[model samples]
Target: MFAKLPFRTGTTSSAIWQGFAGSVMLLLGSLGVGWLASSSVLIRTPLFILARTTPAAVICATVLLCLGALLMFRAWLRLSQHLSGWNDDAGPVLRKALILWVAPMMLTLPLFSRDAYAYIGQGRLMQQDLDPYTNGISALNNYFLLGPDTLWTEAPTPYGPLWLWLEHLAVLIPANSPEIALIPFRLASLAGVVLLAIYVPKLAARHGFNPHRALWLAVLNPVTLMNFIASVHNDSLMMGLVVAGLYYASTKRAVVGILFVTASIAIKPITLIALPFVGLLWAGSRAGWVRKFALWAATLGISMAVMGAMGAVNGLGFGWLAALQTPGTIWHWYAPVGIGSVSLGSLVDWLGGDGTPIADGIQKVAQVISILIVMALAFVKIRLGPSGGLGADLPEPQRYSHAVMRRMAWAFTAVVLLAPMIQPWYVVWLLAFFATTGIKDGWPLRTVFYLSAFFILIALTDQLSVFPWISMEVVRSIAVVVAVMGLLYLTLWDKKTSELFKRNKPDQHAFAVKS
Candidate 1:
């Protein structure tokens, strides 16, 4: 099946196959190094027990995982280089790659995150007729013994009703057993991946971008595979819906597009940022404030109706609105606001004052600032003279659609960067739109490529379950050394991949879409 897909002129069948092999390795290694919570049923399996009990097995598996991640990253870079322009075959090539890479991941225990387990626990809560918004997973018997993170024990679910309803159904299918429930959960996540594969190319082609490059950047990237496939995050489904919705809107089916975006919001409310852009898409390029305002009202009204209907099911209502505050509790250092909050709070503590309130205040202010920035980007038009910047050369008809997508991408980027916490996978929200709008070669393309590689490494090393007896520093050092070795080989030793680091004249028509 992999070989059947047409490859671009310069890309080799052998090179792409390396990524498929790497994914298989990743799955094998994950049996030892992946998240194996104490309550997980898999812990009783012989392979898992042997790997966890023996330090040597753990070390070997970690090395294997890191090596696999490096191989996949290198392959993706090589693939990116050959994507010079639009190829009708790009979609098939990327779709095949997606399947080959994602197949092995489906067999692994949840990698990089225990969120899938939390989904199962939340699903069980639904099975018991509990309102996940008001009650935490802790309401279940022996909830602490389950595989979900302790944070979810008391933290109400932040997911929307559609997601909760799906979770409820998933758990019920397995009689509330977390182990069996994971199968359905993963299958549900895979459905999202399928949506992405189908829509990303269509969206790219609709906007005159290279469908192949867009699909590669958004779908085949390692960060996307690990998060959406291995980690089983609901964000996958949310993003797929966003892309599908945007594609429909770009094609002039505004009402249908608005409905799709609303369904996306039902999966995760974060995509609510996209509603205004959908309104703009509906209002058309020459629409005045009155027309745009009316369309925006219509968009919101339709979205509210859809979301309200979903909320009404099983009496879930709109509690997810308030529960939206749940994820704000986490303050990852990667986020700008998170780091600023911590730095400012530390300074206050140095002066012998309570810094908790001050830190919280910073997050709130940053959140508000981010919202303002997104709104400004979405509404305020900046003139770039005759050549309208990124989408300036596009056909007049497509110019509006292109601009809206570009702004939507930036809007998602702002929200992720300025949010109280930024997860590695959150980047996918912006990536889908940016890829479709067109990422010009040179720094624009290189930046996205490098970031994808960096995130793959982060995902590889960040989530391993270290045993109590093992020195965490030692394990981290080993993983870093192995991963660095792999990087060295790709950047310095491999002929094809080495070209990525060399400075070259920028391609003037890199972003040009074939009409």
Candidate 2:
């Protein structure tokens, strides 16, 4: 029913009509709430000055969120169909239209993203020459930004170089209203989005893989577009660099690959540890080690110089270096720690000991465990023979050059699983890899379905944070269940798992036959 929707790109008029109609409904719903919320409160109040959030509006907004999700599901069904070669003719136009339709999402900051305010405050701190790591926004001491609502005013951004630079731009933009301040910041992410839309598919195609599938993962995935762009997170910029780096590796541009990967590292260093292993595999014994070494050093030197220039201009003066440490800090909704805390906290508190010890212990343990595991995986990936499987059969080079590609998939999967502070959009980086994995096999329908479903559920939790009226536990519990299932699948059901252990694995022939 969903797939047969009138939104198919071949039906050019209908697709545009559907997009316009849907976007209009969403905007009207948003405006209704805005009117009501703004009606009661001071227009300039920092904490959610919803001018029109009457009781009816709240119910209506929640319903709209759910409905918008359903619409997104319908869109995904069609996208998956095109990806599986069911309607191979639909790829180009569908991907192009998707890029256009979703562009506005990146332009606007949605309600759930009070996180953007915290980002602005942190950027203000950078501009004022304060360290965001320790002082948070409080150090800025700007009453208008600090606001009456305490939590958001002082909450620090636990983001990496990619995001801090983005936030720095937002603070620099001259604007009287906070909402106006968000516009330029939102525009900044568009470059990453455009690069992703262009490169991921082209690179996949170069390897004889289904560029369409990779395109969907990077471009059309809902959680990715919403959480990163609308929510204004900088993971897109970091991940875009990774994709560019991967594309370079696929094309055998090892030197360029290392440079792009280093820039990605400069954004979020933890995500790029796997890049060195990829370089090692590509450059084995006969390859030019000296040139590669020089390339890496040059890349790091260039990125650091750029960072230094930006920092100095913002009056940051290398202070952002210290801010990178906070990226390792765990958020309450993050994995491993949040997985145990959300799931076990209730049980522990019920058991009379209070869950403080378990919660505190997991936070400390997660950081150590995550880094250790990533290092171990990098070691295994580097020692591989030309075409030998590291843990799974790599894609045929002539068929698609998925050799290094496969290792990258496993590496990305590992980081997503182990990272102490993973938000839903984090999964977007891996989703692109997973899509290529599917194409390497055959028709990976089941794997595609599960991932799409998991994406919807995780996106729901992030969107759910907005409505203060909803029972927070209700949403958190849903997140716990969804995240746990995803974690279990990545760990236990990977290609490395034997048939017995992973009874419900995706199609075996999916990746088995390439061309």
**TM-score, per-candidate, Cα-based:** 0.93, 0.73
Q: What Cα-based lDDT does every candidate model obtain? A: 0.80, 0.54
| Candidate 2 lDDT for residue 143 | 41
Top-lDDT structure, candidate number: 1
Angstrom error of the Cα, residue 334, model 2: value is 7.7
Per-residue lDDT tens digits for candidate 1, residues 93-183, read: 6667778888998988788888987887898799888989999988999876667888667999989888888887776774434656778
Q: Write the per-residue lDDT of candidate 2 for residues 190-223, one digit (tens) a residue.
A: 6667778777776655544456556665576666
**Model 2: which ten-residue window has the lowest total lDDT?**
32-41
lDDT at residue 19 of model 2 (Cα atoms): 43
lDDT of 1 at 378: 73
TM-score of 2: 0.73
The runs of at least 3 residues in candidate 1 whose Cα sits more than 4 Å from the true structure, single-residue gaps closed, are: 1-11, 83-86, 175-177, 382-394, 512-515
| Candidate 1 residue 490 C-alpha distance from true site, Å | 3.0
